[model samples]
Target: MKRYYQQEEDIGLFQRMQQDDPLAFEEIYNRYFLKLSNTAFKRLQDREMTEEIVQELFVNLWLKRHRLPELKQPESYLQTLLRNSVIDWFRARARQDGFAAEMLAQPDRQIVNATEQHILYADLQQAYESTIGQLPDKCRQVYALHQQGRSVADIADQLQIAPKTVESHLLKAHQTLRHVLKDYSAVAVALFNFVF
Candidate 1:
C-alpha cells in the first residue's frame, strides 16, 4: 500500500539520519523543504521569513535528529515543526511592536538634558554597532548603504548584485539584529520597519 511504503521510506530515512547519515538527512531536506516553504509562505506571505523558517526547521531537525520524535507520518511531523516556528516568529514580532508602543506611551518626568541625551545616544550607538557587527560581509555592506537611505535597486547596482540579493541580505541582517537587540525593542522595531 502507499501508506506502507511511505512508512518504510520515512523509517529508513529517520534511522539513517539518527545514525548521522548525510545522504539520508539531505533526502529529508529535499523532500520537505519546498513543501514546507510553500506552506509557510502561504501563511506568512514573506519569502525571506518563509525561507528562514524552513531553513531553521531543517537545521534543528539535523541537530536533534538522534532524538527525533516517533511519528506515523514524517511529513506531518515537519509540517508541525514549521507551523510552530511560524507561531513563535509572529509572537516575537508582536512583542517587539508592543514594546515599542509601550515605550512611546510612557510619560517622561522632564525633558532629557544634554547629559541624559549623550548617555542615551551612547547606549543606542553601542547596541546598534554590536548588532551590525554580527552581519555577514555582504549583508553588512548592504545594510550600511541601506541605512544611508539607499534603495534596494541602488544597493544592488552599487554592489553589482541583483535586487533580490540585496533584499535577501537586508532581510537576513534585519532578522539577526532584531533577535540580538531584544532589550532595545524600540530601536529594533523602528529599524525593522525602516528596513522593509
Candidate 2:
C-alpha cells in the first residue's frame, strides 16, 4: 500500500491521503490552497468568503479523506467543489438581502397605517359628537338608544313614543349626521354602519 508521497507526478500521494497520512495531506493543502483561494476570489470577488471557502475545502478534505480514492481528477474535483460553494454563497446572500429589505420597509408601512387609523378615528369622533349635539332632543335620544343595540320598538316603549316616531327620529339623525360629516363621509359611513 502507498504509505507516503512526494509531489512529483505521484498518484501515490492520493493513496497515502486515503490512509490518513498527515504529511501527504499537508503537501496537498500547501500546494493547492493559494490556487483555490485565487480561483474562488476571482469568481466571488469577496475576500472573506473566498478565504472561508478555501479553508472549508481543506477542512472537508481532511475529514472526508476516505472518500478521496474516488477523486481520480484532483484538480478538476477541487475546482468543482469551489465552484459549487461559490454558487451556494451567492444564493444564500440573495435570500438574506431580500429578507432584510422586507424587514427594513416593514416599520414604515406600520407607522403610516397606525397614523392613518388614529387620524380617521379622531375625525369620526369629532363629527359624531358635534353633530349629535346639534340633533333635536328626541332624535338624539333615539339615535343613542339605537346605537346601544335597542330595538326601535323597545326604544319607543321606553321613551313613550310611537315606533314610527322612533324610526323617523333615527332617519333624521342619520341624514343630518351624514350632511355634517360630508368631508369624512366615507370613513364615517363605515364606522356608522357598525354603530347604528
Candidate 3:
C-alpha cells in the first residue's frame, strides 16, 4: 500500500512537472522544501545557508523536471541530495577560506581569463540577489547587506542593532536563500548569459 501511494505520487508529480504546471511544482515544493531545509540545517547548523542550499536544489529539480526519473521514494531522494549538497558546501567553504590550501597549491592551476572571471562573479552576485529577493522582508534585507560586502559590525551599525543580532539574521537569511535557490545553476547560467 505504501509503495503504491509513493508510486502514484511520484508519477503524478513527474508528469505534471514535465508539463510545466506551476501548481505541480508548488505541490512538490510544499511537500519537500521544509523537510529538506531541516535536513540541511541539521548538517550545516546554519539556517540561512541551509535554506539557500535547499532552494537551489528544488529550483534545479524544477528546471530539470522533464529529465527526472521516477522516484522509488521522493522523500529519500530529497534527503540524500540535501546531505550531499551540505557536504559539498562545507568542502567549498573550507577551500575558499584557505583551510585546504595544501590541496589547491598545485603549480598546474589553470588560470581563467579576467573577463570571464569577472563575468562569472557578477553573474553569481546577480543570481544571489535574485534568490535573496524571494525571501521574507527581514531575511532579504539582512542578506542584501551581506551581499553588499558589509561586515557584521557594519550591518549592525546600519541597522542599529547588536553585532550578534546581525550575525543571527545573516545566518537565518543564508539558510533560507540556500534552501530556496538549491540547484539554481541552470538559471544562474542563463541569467549570466543574458546579462553578459
Candidate 4:
C-alpha cells in the first residue's frame, strides 16, 4: 500500500519535472539523494568521490528532466545511471594509473616473462607518445589536461574554450590515440577506450 502511494508520488514528481518545475526536481533530489549517496558510497568507498558522483547524478537528472515523463521508475533509472557513473570513475582511475600497469597488473602477466613485459611496456610508451604527438596543438593540450585529471569544464575554463569544443578535442585525441595504439597493442587500445 505504501509502495503504491510512493510510486504515485514519484510519477507526479516526474510529471512536474517534465514541465520544468524546479520544486519538483528539488523534491526528487531530496527524496533520493541520501539513498543514492549510500549506494554510491558502498560501491566507491570514498566519501568525496561518492559525493561527487551522486551530485553529478542529480545535476544530470535536472539537465535531462524533460525526458522524465518517459521513465516508468525514476529510482531504477537513477540507480542505473549511478552504476554506470561508478564504472566510468573506476575506468578513468585505471587510465590515469598508466597503460603498462593497466595491461600488466593482471594475474595473467605473472605467467609471462618480465623481460617481455618490459619490452612491451617500452614499446607501448613510445607508441603512446608518438600518437599523442600526432594530435593538433589545441587538441593535444586538451588531452594533456584531461590526463592530468582536469575536468572537461575545468579544461574549457582554463583554455578559454567552450565545453563542447573541449569535448571535441578530447574525442579527436581519443580516436587518434586508439587507432594508432591499436596497431601497437590491442590491450592498450582496450584500456584506452575508457577515456570516453
Candidate 1 per-residue C-alpha lDDT over 1-196 given as tens digits, one digit per residue, 9 for 90 to 100: 3344345586688887889987777777777789888877866778998898899889999999878877556766776677678767766786677844654565452234335646665676677688788778999999988766566888899889999999999889978876766665453344333323
Poorest stretch of ten by lDDT in candidate 3? 187-196
Deviation of model 2 at 136, angstroms: 96
Candidate 3: tens digits of C-alpha lDDT, residues 131-190: 766777766776677755466787788888888888888888767656654655543433
Q: How much does candidate 2 score in TM-score?
A: 0.46
Kindly report which residue stretches of model 2 are placed more than 4 angstroms away from their true locations once superposed. Answer: 1-4, 99-196
| TM-score on alpha carbons, each prediction | 0.48, 0.46, 0.48, 0.48
TM-score of 3: 0.48
Q: How well does model 4 score by local distance difference test? A: 0.75
Task: Please provide the root mean square deviation of candidate 1 (C-alpha atoms, Å).
Answer: 15.2
Best by lDDT: 4
Sequence-dependent TM-score of model 1:
0.48
Better of 2 and 4 by lDDT: 4
Can you write out model 4's per-residue Cα lDDT over 93-162, one digit (the tens) per residue? 7668784564667756645645675777677778888878878999999998887657689899999999
The local distance difference test score of each candidate is 0.73, 0.74, 0.67, 0.75
What ranges in model 1 sit over 4 Å off? 1-8, 99-196
Residue-level error in angstroms, candidate 4, position 76:
0.5
